[model samples]
Target chain A: MDIIEILFTASFWAAAIRIATPLILATMGELICERAGVLNLGIEGIMVVGAFAGWMAVYSGTGLWAGVAVAFIVGMAFGLLHSTLTVPFGLSQHVVGLGVTLLATSATYYAYRLALPEVTSPPKIAAFQPYEIPILSDIPFIGEALFSQTPFTYFAFLLVLAVAVVLYRTPLGLAVRAVGENPSAVAAQGLSVTAIRMGAVIVGSGFMAMGGAFLTMSAFDSFFFEMVNGRGWICIALVVFGSWRPGKALLGAILFAAFDALQIRVQQTEIGAEIPYQIFLMMPYILSILALVVMSRRAEVPAALMVPFNKGER
Target chain B: MNLRKNKRVTMRLEPIENPTMLRRLGLPAAVLAATFLVASLLAMIAGANPFSVFGLIIKGAFGSKFAVLETLNRATPLIFTGLAVAVAFRAKFWNIGAEAQLYAGALVTVVLGTGLLPWPAFAILPALFVCAILAGAIVLLVPALLKTRFGVDEVVTTLLFNFIFLLFISMLLEGPLKDPMGMGWPKSARLIPEARLPRIVDGLRLHWGFALALISAGLVWIIQTRSTLGYEMRAVGLNKEAAAFAGIPVNRVLVKTALLSGGLAALAGFSEVAGLKGSLTLDLSPGFGYTGIIVAMLALLNPLGVVVAALFVAGIFVGADSMSRAADVPTYLADIMLASALLMMVLAIMLTRFRVVRG
Candidate 1:
């Protein structure tokens, strides 16, 4: 195996990065909400909402970028709905998440058709066009693979720093973390736990919406039934694997992308021809569980990840 | 929503409000009334008479001998998946991987149906069923292991496997397992006759798998009620710390439930291969596993209730399809109907669980 040959292929890393972005966005979204003490198991449905909303926007003459904004709105709406069910209604997070998934599924399959009967075709607009950096193009393989990408590519990286600042430096961030750790203690100070969490959820879902927007307006630019697939759930797993850190989550996404890329490569070549294809395809999941087992000891899991805060409880 | 400190501490130790039978009956009636009214409105929109269309949907779904058979064929897989979900729900576990488990079961069915087993037909059917069950169980082992050992959330993990498992199946069918008999399509060889689940009431699609599913539901009911293990399991579900104090292995109970859930979902796959398709198709379950969650919840996780609830769901589902072909209404509407019903059911459940009174 010539390392040079593997490194030089544009198609290889492009597809890999494309495959990983949705997971990255979804997990990043999960990270923010998780840090705020609300472990949103609803990211899956949130992404689905984005996928449908994005596609519907495009199918009705709005461009792909318009779809991106629409998806953001849709994602926020899901966050709002989840907030009402969990925060106000006192529903179980797991049950609410499950219900949201079913709702999203129904919405994706039916709501779009109900809303847009005129669009005969499943929306297939222009995806986000890729661009190569001019100065960075001088350096060969690494620069091309790393820098030459879409606007969301840069946003995803920038979001890590932004979220890190908000999580650590800001007063709101401190309040949010304090709430997660001990809501009663925070409530004693008169800061609103409900408001901060609702804000976090909306912002978190915006990140997830970008992920879904990428799937529709960037990844393949067409909406299929169950198109978001299970990347949202995978993102939830990444939140755990990434140890609730945005930087570590980017690495996990890239690592997953690498595995997915390798699967495609194997499918195209004779090297892994002897291996049963099903076994090879499941490599990413197998590796994820294995990585989890090895990393769980070192991971700084949130002390109050999914423990629903009941302020009045003893 | 009502967070009262006085009620939180020791008030729960004493019984408060018990829901009356009229209120309990009212919830289901509301759902039925809403569904019929909504369906009738949709029928009018489609330019068909509401009453006549409603009749047709039911008649096409269950009116004639053949239509009734079709409903049974559709309902068989739902029974298995519905029961699988009911087990998890009773234990307060959310198992969303039934779709993936069903696929895993289907993958196993293909392996046994086509791969060299060196066995007779009668032996092959039993072997295929066992293999399918094993496949489904294996996928669930990860989530169970994660939950018990690492305290990772199983809901996300099991749900993610649904996507991963389906992709693996797609890769297999397209590459290594591509049918030798077909010209380029991603399918496998038809099952050997011995491996096929026998048909019941010939000339219709009803199969022996229906009998197996109903019997399995009975078995689940027995295990959940009559057995000592059931008592311990319910005790763990009711209060994990209390169960642990009483020396029940809480983790072991969860693991067992997870495995049983996976196995039952896989059995749904077994029926699909053995009775419906006669071979593994990519669309094995038609979201039966996902729909099973709604069914199990509607049934309140009672195993016996799952059968009746599953049949009702299956009826609506098949009826939706028939209505689509006959009345030009989209089948996707059924999904919307079910989701709305479940959303309403949750509120109804919460209301039924407790009563609020002004102090």
Candidate 2:
């Protein structure tokens, strides 16, 4: 099929939304962390831990929602370790973040081996299935593309709206924003900058874990190595592409996912037969760099980002 | 001003005027103990006796001549990558694309060594080495330039480049550089015997790459301690604003750092393909670029210390691989140990300069 013809198909849009589900969740997670002035480079490994934890929980006789809760809690536990080092001790975020990633990934792999020693193939669990809304499912092509998705996708969409409202419309959001931009100002206002930053990281990391859980529980049934596959890093780029805004970040995720879906379909066409398939795989990373370059100038980074705040110190 | 409102007593860090030698030595020792403690806990969780696991690891690492040589072989690539990270991090340039640069080096090695250079061994070897360095250097130069000119963050760009370059390599292996005579595997053509690096000793599996790594480490130490560029890099790392005020070209120094770091990491790829495998494959250096960060940090980013750190890190990996066969625990315990050691070492380094006081 031609490019325009593929774009017009409902299946293409449905695939695009499916691909964007994880990115949207993870981008919002990263947005919350960066907006709080802590760069969580541990997103990649935390996502791995999340994928494994959620799947393992479901396989071990828990409901799917309970498995997601397990993933979120486990992710938050790691976040606590991260924040304690970075916030209270005021360590280098870069080193600590990388260390956390290494720690989380290795720990996850170790646990996976211990849990399923005799099995070569990763066992699958009963995953979340697509749920069609009552009235929306009866509508035209747009309904099938958007509304007929797993409950996880609907939750992801609602999350973006919730995050947007909390960030701009709530007092807690103002305090979170102020802590990232000017911690000393927050300190002068009788607020504990440490508490806000730590809280933001912990809660944000939970969301990131949920994104990973979506892959295992919604996108695919089984957990495997390399499945998260740089989605967390892509979400980091999305945050930059959105300039750290929730609504814009959600759009960026969908746009990126569209390109991803397009590439997968393009590989099936006659033109794809002539080119090496690896070229198609390389597009997302290349586009992320391009997006960073295009938006870097206008992007308004948090003023205190990566700068540790020590009370009563210059 | 809000001290009256919040009456809770909290601990704070105060810089110590002069830390005693014992405090400096004792704290890191304690941190090491803590890392081992965590490792033991993990082993226990895996249903293995912690003491036996530790014993097996030590015996596996240094038990026989073969085991020692195996460690030395592993350390060769790590030394190069560790030095790459040390140099760049010392200049405060986050060159996380060492993995990409390493592949670029290997790609060049295969392209030139697979009968493409119809010259004598002596003439071709040096040409291949120089070209590999240049290829790796050019790969990293793009991100460095982007950071300087466009205000782009190098961390994300460099990390993203790793994925991009790996795919690019995959494309080459499947298309232009495919080994036609071999079975249907995605691998490149092998280097001719003349292009291969010579073994350091007769009947020994060890190659000259280990010697090259040692010499490279010594050279880096000299550059870090005796050269003007090293001084400039340290100054830039310590404080960029002060260095710029002191007439140091901050951006130029960062670009130069990218070149040196990328070239060093590329040597790992060159050594692996030329000195060991004689052919390029996808899994050439399993996360050596990322592991280099651990090696560099554990060494406190010192050049000579990186060599020792690489040896230590390589020993854990070699030992753990052997231990896994004899024990129920997984081989990933080594990674967990190194990561925890890195975190603890950084924290210990900070504690050496400061003391905690509860107020």
Candidate 3:
């Protein structure tokens, strides 16, 4: 009816939560990788492969859980490739990440065509449904948004807390952060920098893949070409916007998701009928760029980012 | 010279001051072989016959006159984009917005070609080309400025600008620039005959654009090796702090090279529009900008090597398309092969520069 009413509705918040889930998942994954000094541009392609893996598993008569498991494993494989190139081979991270993305996206498309063979309508799977927490569901406005969500959404929120705690509190977390800042110092302390980086990549990539699996499993039932729709790239921006903190990253995800939800809702209203919808789609990206420019001064980029560590070199 | 005899020193790995020609060539060859083996395994996993697919690719890319011409035609735009990428990467600018810059060029050309200018038939192509290059460069000016002035990361800024350009183009096509007589399709009006690039041959689709691509490559090589500007750019690329210490204007070098890079990438769109399509449309570039990065990297950002690398990369893509049609293998096999090849090439280059020592 009215703009304020539209923004405040329960349905709007639910939509925002739903839209934000994948972004949160991706941001969480990217935070770990960036924290460890790897910019995995392969997230886009990994997500596509993950989406495909989940879709194929379900299409091939497996359960939804099995599909998600397969997706996570597939994502980790790409992470391993990135690690091999960047960690041990000491190659350029930007080039390697882009190459991995191209490879994964192409491989996913090829596999989908070979296995499915039919292109009339895309194949679909029975997707994950929302599970409402019993008592939590009874609350008024925020209940539907926070309590009743796909299993993945709840897991995504829990992951934000988990990542924050692990990153700030644990020795392994300290090692990962230390390696990003000063790999030489970490090496002198008798820790395997490569091992820690490799672990961070694999774990980060698993979460990235889970984000994709969630898309196919919960966001929508079927896969399509470019369904990830630059969310992986958005996640890259979010990592910077969030200032590499899990709490801030989640807040950024929610902010983006809210705008996304608003766009979809506004597109259907009478007042929004006159405007071109592309403007709405462009909002999040434009906002992120502005935000990055403003926050870049204080943002703590890893000191050793994009630099390959040669153990003996200055 | 110590009174007590020192323990004999063991041999240690040292970085070579200059590698021989043979090592340079052999390392790349080995890397190619390793990547091929890996890609073959991937193809097998995808349920295709790897040997047959490889054979088909070679045959389809270069087995006949028709295939060779097609490969070159596909390679025309890549050469421009590759050079664009090589130029920026040589200066260490890393402009990833070539795709959008290409679109910007195409947009300028389309707007001008569709009755914006009254230039004579003989002058339209050159005018459009120049304008498009300027438009492409202008589109990147903001990012370059931000990068130099504010310490913003060019990679992110350029990428965000790409989405902006694409959306802007989509808006134009769907709103003001829609074709008036395509029976409701959202296409632009075809370019006038005078605006089209003349074909180089009677029967083949190859145009004068191929010559432009070659000349651009040669010019890039000359500029990179012989010119003062190129020297400054390279110096900046190697180390900004050192270049600044050496009295080079690092910011000027970065901004100017980025403009040139964007201009070169835009020329690709100009060639595609004038030579092949003769009009603007959605999906004009099949990720040529991204592929350009691969081509440049495969050549190690050497300008002359870019010519060979672009052709090689284009051949795989074109050949894979043919193979998919003829042998029923998907075109994505080529992508897997290309990715592995790039990975291996970069790995080989790095490995050749450093050797392990037994301490």
Which candidate tops TM-score? 2
lDDT of 3 by residue, A201-290 (tens): 888888898899888889999998889977888898888889889999999999889888888888888978888877877887787778
Worst 10 residues of 1 chain A by lDDT: A305-314
In the range A139-203, model 2's lDDT, one tens digit per residue, is 89989899899998999999999999998999889988998999899988888788888888998
Over the stretch B237-349, how does candidate 3's per-residue lDDT look in tens digits?
89999999999999999989988999999989888888889778888998898899889989999988999998999899988888888876677888878877887888778
Clashes of each: 0, 0, 0
TM-score of each: 0.87, 0.98, 0.95
Cα lDDT computed for each candidate against the true fold: 0.76, 0.91, 0.85
lDDT of 3 at B243: 99
Model 1 ranges off by over 4 Å? A1-18, A63-65, A112-123, A131-143, A265-280, B1-16, B31-56, B107-110, B113-131, B171-179, B355-359
Models sorted by TM-score, best on top: 2, 3, 1
Of the pair 2 and 3, which is ahead by TM-score? 2
Name the weakest run of 10 consecutive residues (lDDT summed) in model 2 chain A: A305-314
Error of 2 at B106 (Å): 1.0
- lDDT of each residue in B1-359, candidate 2, tens digit only: 23222775655678888999998899878987998899999999999999999989887887899999899999999999999999999998998888999999999999999989878778888888899889889999999999999999998999999999999998888888989976978899999887788899998989888898899889988988899999999999999999999999999999999999999999899999999999988999899999999999988899898999999999999999999999999999999999999989989989998777874
Q: Please tell me which predicted candidate would have the highest lDDT against the true structure.
A: 2
Instruction: For residues B67-123, write the lDDT of model 1, one tens digit per residue.
Output: 888888888898899999988777766788899999888888878787468986668
